[model samples]
Target: MQKFPAVLSVALLLAGCAMSSTQFDATREALRGSPPLRQQAIADCTANQARRSLQARQDAARVMNVSVRAMPRTICTRLVAGWSSGRLSYDDYRSAMVGSMTPNTVRIIQGR
Candidate 1:
């Protein structure tokens, strides 16, 4: 029949559209499942938070002329590294930095 080609073309067009939509959705879901950019974004956010906290402690210590105890482990190792590098005394460092070690800081030091 003369109508057969028209029907076939229309069906093919519809099928192509369906396939395109499915592909787009699949791509989106795949990206959502394990997005590297999002993972990196979270990591960056965590690092920035740690940096700000450490800075806040340093600033506070400067104002008080005494470092506070119980810093996050990440901050503590950084502080300890500073001490080991001759930036601070072992005794004074211990006094200034006790209880400041957070688990996250420890993890950071351990290369986690």
Candidate 2:
């Protein structure tokens, strides 16, 4: 049926939205350990985030894509706190990190 194509397309789009392994590893490393370690990780994360965001932006432009305009600076206090305090599991935190940094999420935040 015609609906099959639409359903499959939606599935593929969602699957493509996952964060890459490099981002996952960096975040995992940053989430654990002492305050000083976290501080250093935050610095590294922000720098990497900026570079990756720029590359993503340029790639999207080249592809004439509108789905993801950017990757926000993902190192934030709330995420760190949640992860540090065990309020959020590593997987959940990773999902939240990706969700929070989406272009749509940024739009919502800015509008509020």
Candidate 3:
């Protein structure tokens, strides 16, 4: 029916107008397509969220060239715990930290 086509277009329009969570997350401003780091989960990574409340309590300090306080709470805690436990390698922590802090730009996704 003619009404069905109109209804379909309305549905598509509504869906298109919807904004993704990244549009509003402050931490994710640096990351494109990547939601806030708070949304980035480390699979199989285990840390007591408060367990690393769990603090060296140092700010502006660098370990593995990563800012101690710069990362999201869950990520920072896991990184610290994993590092201290000797389970996470220096390279691992460094890569994860730097990657998290790096601003994500559209250029990163351009096809060569």
Whichever of 2 and 3 has more TM-score, that candidate is 2
Give the per-residue lDDT digits (tens) of candidate 1, residues 68-90: 33233333333333323333233
Q: Which candidate achieves the best TM-score against the true structure?
A: 2
Please tell me which model should have the higher lDDT, number 1 or number 2: 2
Best of the candidates, lDDT: 2
lDDT over C-alpha atoms for residue 33 of model 3 = 39
- After superposing candidate 2, which stretches have Cα over 4 Å from the reference? 1-33, 54-74, 93-112
RMSD of 1: 26.7
Q: Candidate 2's residue-wise lDDT over 4-105, tens digit each?
A: 111112111222345555654544556565787656544544344344445443542333223233322232333344444554343443433333233322
Clashing pairs in 2: none
lDDT for model 3 comes to 0.27
Give the lowest summed-lDDT range of ten residues in model 3.
Answer: 103-112
**Where does candidate 3 stray beyond 4 Å?**
1-71, 97-112
Q: Lowest-scoring 10 consecutive residues by lDDT in candidate 2? A: 1-10
lDDT of 1: 0.34
How high is the CA lDDT of each candidate model?
A: 0.34, 0.37, 0.27
TM-score for all predictions?
0.20, 0.36, 0.22
